[model samples]
Target: MVEQVDILVVGGGVNGVGIARDAAGRGLSVWLCERDDLAAHTSSASTKLIHGGLRYLEQFEFALVGKALAEREVLLRAAPHIIWPLRFVLPHQPHLRPAWMIRLGLFLYDHLGRGRRTLPGSRRVRFGKHVTGEPLRADFSVGFVYSDAWVQDARLVVLNAMDAARRGVHIETHTRCVSARRDGEGWTAELESRDGSRHFVKARALVNAAGPWAASFLDDVAHVKHQHSLRLIKGSHIVVPKIFEHRYAYIFQQPDRRIVFAIPYERDFTLIGTTDVEYKDDPSHPTITAEETSYLCDAANRYFKKQLTPDDVVWSYSGVRPLLQDEAGSASEVTRDYLLDIDQNGPPLLNVFGGKLTTYRKLSEEAVDKLAPLLGNHQPAWTADARPLPGGGERDIDELLADVRATRPWLPETFAWRLVHSYGTRARDLLGEADGLNALGEHFGADLYQAEVDYLVRHEWATEAEDILWRRSKLGLRVTPPDVQRLTDYLSTKR
Candidate 1:
């Protein structure tokens, strides 16, 4: 039997789920399918920041910067549990960029976006007296501090899918849209699950939110013609032991004019990234090259008093960015802004191209706005003024954390903090009627108990151990291999 819906969204990344949530909330019947887990690819492999690309100012992308800056506050309000303010320290480098230039750019970043509240503006700091100066090389005496936000990137994607599901959208993870054909007034799509089961759907409209695979999906999967082109760039990051003792992150200016960041990660480690190299390989499973690893270490070594080598890297990840093709000399210079192409030659098909995490909500809002009218639905834009995403109703995260700890006095401080930051009010739901740690369920490793694991499987569509350890939470940094095997065995039995 072929099920029918008003819209069928292909891809489960940020934009895909974001659109699903927006469309479903507007009373449209929405169905979304992903070839792998939610955020299994590019969406999860971000530098994990929500900011008004300070560097984009150099590229003269003022419009993009302004749009992103506005979304920063909206996202913080939407998901305070996973998104919060972060201060970035930029050590002075007179030889690379002048102080005046930096100041001018920051001034625009502060004032360009509307509804900028809660976050402080940029200011200069003395490395000799400030806590951010403790780990920098002695040569750096003055620097600038700016505000941005950090996010659990993968969790952000899942939460959008969760919100969409709650609003009556059908979310199918581990399901692939094998073929989509426009027939008469709508589309007939064949979807295949990982277990080799196939299902069919008929929809009034189709949305292609495939990120890195957007273009190829048009050619190979959908077999459609398009005038759009994508420039694939590989960006890689490395995680090492904490390089600094402070809570502040560092943004270093390289001689090549690109910037690298060393941010706090997983409580005990430091995250450094991102080299932009032109890529021409399969987007799936792009591994970090040794040269890329050395590049990140050298970038950090240039700024920190403590030197680093490739051997110091505890973990690494890489992703291919499907940037909109433009006349640019370098990969890093390609536009981070996105484009929405609506092919109205047949039944309306919207193709999403070239977006960063900071502007996903806005991109989604626009995508739905364009399509909703085409489908004869006149729902006004509502996501901006909507309530926070599930588990994010509480505005003050610190107060929520304290309340959880107060209610569950037996919960350890670190464990309680993790839960509150990861789930906000939903942490209590995970605890249920449990009175103590033992009642929570069997301890797999670290702070992970069976209760949380079961909650992930039941509520968040988690299937694999990596989904729990790496994506849902960064517990992979602490969980033993034996513990992972135990979790895998348990999941197998549940299946």
Candidate 2:
């Protein structure tokens, strides 16, 4: 079958979804195709922070810092549910960069950006005074507290896709674009769906937003050559038992001067990581290396009261960052800035290179702006100051929570707050007019209810049980194997 659209976006990662959403909102007919499930790759495997890279200050990347910091507030306001303010405690170590440099970086970070809303600026915390500093070693007398945002990376992609679809973008999951060719005036793209269906889509413009596969898609799939090259750097993270009492995440400096984040994840686990190493292998199946694990563990062990080893790790994941090579000596030093390669020889194909989660919206807006001329009469960028995500459209979460409590007063305050944090205003959408715990149908463990699973399957495009247990929600930490089996069987029946 042959279909036509104004624009075709090839990857369903954050960048691709962002582009599709922007393009669709701009009144362009758009089609977004993802080979695997949305966010099945690097977008979901991020460090899960929407912060201005504090460490990037060392690299003197002021422009990136400003852009990210500005977007932090933009996203927090846009999706206050999944994205919220996080306080980071950076304990000073003697061996690391001196206190002066740290202070300088923090000062620049505070002043680099213009607008600040929910999050406060950097402040010095005393180990004896603040509860967050209590877990630190006695020698760590002082620390700096700065603002950043934590994002549900996977759902962020989903929210963008949802918005795109709502704004008239055709979203196809498990559909891979095998080839693309320019036919006289426009472009012809071939796609294969999950059910062994073949499709040919013709479009005025094509966007190669494939995360790690940007180069591969351009060269092999699109049959075009690119001047820029993508440098794949594998960054891995380990989820271990919660080691600290504070709600604030820790930003620790390693011996090699690389900073590792010990973030509070899923309420019960401390998510620590990220080792940056050159990865030349497949981006699809990047595995956590022992050396990276050791590096992360060592970095965590430096400041935390409890030591972490491979055995303590419950889950480990690695993501290959499709970085635009800028001739940096080390992978860690590579710039996180994205590049738009627009080819106007025929129909323009905008290939996005390197970008972090924090800067995706801006990147998308800029990308569409670049391709606007090719598709004459394109709509102006409208995503810069958008409102809440699909479920997070409301301004008041407390009001929504009160509504949820009224509906299900049996929900404990903490657990109810957890649901509110996860689902935002959509808490009622899942719990729906259910009066009590039983009305929620079944308790699968943790805060997970049967109603939530149904809502995910129906509205959020949840296919597998793991998608519900892990990515969609962190109920995997609490749900039993038998419960998971039951859910899996139920999902199978739905198919």
Candidate 3:
């Protein structure tokens, strides 16, 4: 028997999963497929920020910034465990940008989209009086502080997929939509699974939320023609040993007018990123260039009292952004806004172009709001005020940690903290009836044990060690090689 759905969404990135979740909530039968693991590419490689893009103000992207600013709180409310408030310290550089300009940007950031009500407002801090300033160079005395939120990027993608599944959306990971064609009144597509098997799917409407592969998916897979094109821009980041002891993150302005962010990551390291370079290669396996490594190091060196080099980098990653093509002078100047163009010449077809992770919910809401009416389904737009993601029920992670400890006092203090922040209230579900650390089963490494692995595989679609280590959790940073091999062997048995 051939399978069918109301909407068939391709690509399992943030935008793809977000769209699937929204469509499913609106009472639509949806099916989403990804060639690889969810968030295997660009979505997982983000700078991991839920910000208003403070730099975009120079580009006069007020509308985009406002749109993103509004979603910050909405996402925070939905997933407080993975999304929490973070303050940024920007050391003043009178030569690069004046104080008044920075203040104006902060003011607009504060007021735009009613950005800061729950989080603290922006303020100026003196290095002499503030603890955050002590790590900076002596010459750097004062700077501005602002509010933004951090996200567990890959987990955000998975949570959306999980929510969609709960609402009856069929999710197929490690499955590729090899061919899609408009057939009869709807669309017929072929999906190929990982073990060399094929399945046919029919859908009333097709959605192309393929991220960097969006343009190519239209050209090659669907064999559809359109005027839209994507300019692939590569952004890279470097992780080094902890640069600062505080919880505060820093956004540095470079001489070239672009910015670099050094954020606290995995509790033991500083995550510094993101050099934007023009890219024309395959987007699947983008690696950080040596020059980008130096650029990020130099960018950080200019602000901090401590100096760093390429050797200091413990790990690095890169993602190719499919920014909508425009007549911009440089890659940095290209707009980060997204476009949704629905082709209705044959069956109703929706193609999602460039978008940032910050505005994915709004993008999904708008995408479905446009596509739903065409399919004779006028379910009111939901998800904005809807239920929270799987583990997001508890807003106070500290309290959740306290509660988990109260019940499972045998669990290490640090171990309990990791579980609560990673899985929220569902941490208890992962714990099951385990009474002690040994009962959680064989230890893979660090605090990771068999019970957590089983829960991830059964619930979160983790099929491999890398999926658990890198994407599902950043435990890759702490686990040893022998332990990873042990995990790989164990997962092989489960598969």
Candidate 4:
């Protein structure tokens, strides 16, 4: 039997989840399928920022920069828990991009966005005055400070999915769309979930919002032939112990003209990343090589006071950026902007190629708007300046912390801060009626409360322990081997 729906979204990445949320909110019966866990792919493995790409301006991608900048504030308000304002210090070097040019880029970055709030505008910083410059070499006497927002990329995707589900969308995790065939006036698709259950669904319209798998999904549609290509470029990031003093991040210019980000991750570690190289391997299995690790470490050592080795790495991950090939010479130069191709002839398939975490919401809105005419009906775009996600409750962080302390004064100040960072306004929901630390239940070591673990499994669709330990929260770093085994064994019993 085939279950019918108004719309079907392929792939479970950020773009697909964002589109699903938008379509479902508009009162459409939306069904979404992912072959793996939500954000088990590239969506989770990002440098984890929601800022306008400052480096894009060097490529003269003003329009893209402008769109990303505008979305920054929207996202911050939408998910303030996970997305918070961050300062970046670009240390000046003589051989790198000229200072005047860098200043010009910052100028455009500051003015491009529409609604700007707590984020401070760009300004010059004296190397000696600011702590951010402490880790820099002696010769680097100047720098510029600018604003951006950090995001929990995995949570962002999960929150979008959760919101979509709340709005009556049927989300099938661990499910893959095996086949799609044209029916009388719609399409019939078969989905096979991980539980060995096969289900069929019919939809009026299909969206190939599959990130790296867009092309393959397109091929599944009979008679919808096109020559559009996406270049799969793999980017990797490494997490190491904190190497800098200040909260501000660093954007270092490499000799090859590539820029790398050294951002403060969590509170104890630093997240340095992202090398853009052509990937010919499977998108699902993109792995970081020895060379890639060395490259990133080398880049970090070049600009910082201390030289880092691979031994310092505590965690690492890699993801493929599905880039629309526009004939760029270098992978680093490929457009971070997205492209949409709507097939009106054979059947409706909106193919999304190339997008960033910062731009997913806007991209989804545009995609839904494009589909409105094709579906023979339309709804006004609503995600603009809209809230996403869970955890980003309306209450300000200060008040929320004060309230938590009022209720549970025995809770460690540091742990309370962690709760605020993780759950934002929803911290109370996670903590519940707990009066003290012990009431929070079993601790899997280092702030890993039983309540949080349960919340993740029940709400966030976390089936595995690693999802809780590593991706959803970085408690895995602090938890011991026996503690990890305990959590792992407990989750196995649940399944």
For all predictions, the C-alpha RMSD in Å is 0.9, 1.7, 0.9, 1.7
Model 1 lDDT tens row, 204-250: 99999999999988998889999999999999999999988888888
Single out the weakest 10-residue window by summed lDDT for candidate 1. 109-118
Q: After superposition, how far is residue 394 of candidate 2 from its true place, in Å?
A: 3.0
| Alpha-carbon shift of residue 448 in model 3 (angstroms) | 1.0
lDDT of 4 by residue, 1-495 (tens): 778988889888899999989988787889999888888888988899998899988888989989999899888878877788898888888677788998888898899865665678999999898888789878789989999998888888988988899999898888898887667777788899898899899998888877887887767643357788899999999989999767889988899999899999878989998999999888988888899999999999988888899999998889999988887899999999998778766457777888999999999999888986677667788887566467676647778788887888888988898888777777888888888778978788888878888888888788787788766877777889999888887777666
lDDT of each: 0.93, 0.86, 0.93, 0.85
Give the per-residue lDDT digits (tens) of candidate 2, residues 1-495. Answer: 578898999999999999999888878899989998788889988999998899999899999999998888889888988887888999888677888888899998887776765678898888788887666666788888998889989989988888888899988878999999988777899999878889899999999999899998988889897787989999999999899877899999888888899999887789997889999998898999888888898888878767778999988889999998987998899999989989888888888999999999999999989987688856777886877888787667777778777767788987788788777877767777777778887677766778887888777778788778767877787788888888888788765
- Per-residue CA lDDT of model 3 for 1-495, tens digit only, reads 688889999999999999999999989999999999999999999999999999999999999999889999899998899899999999999999999999999999998898446888899999899988877889999999999999999999999999999999999999999999999999999999999899999999999999999999999999999999999999999999998899999999999999999999988899998999999999999999889999999999998888999999999989999999999999999999999999998888999999999999999999999999999999998898887899999778888899999999899988898888889999999998999988999999999999999999998889999999999988888899999999999999997
Q: What is the model-wide C-alpha lDDT for candidate 1? A: 0.93
What residue pairs clash in candidate 4, if any at all? Answer: none
Roughly what TM-score does model 4 have, to 2 decimal places? 0.96
Error of 1 at 120 (Å): 0.5
Provide the lDDT at 390 for model 4.
75
TM-score of each: 0.99, 0.96, 0.99, 0.96
State the RMSD for candidate 4: 1.7
Which one is best on lDDT? 3
Q: Global CA lDDT of candidate 2, please? A: 0.86
From the highest lDDT down, the ranking of the candidates is 3, 1, 2, 4
Let me know the TM-score candidate 2 reaches against the reference structure: 0.96
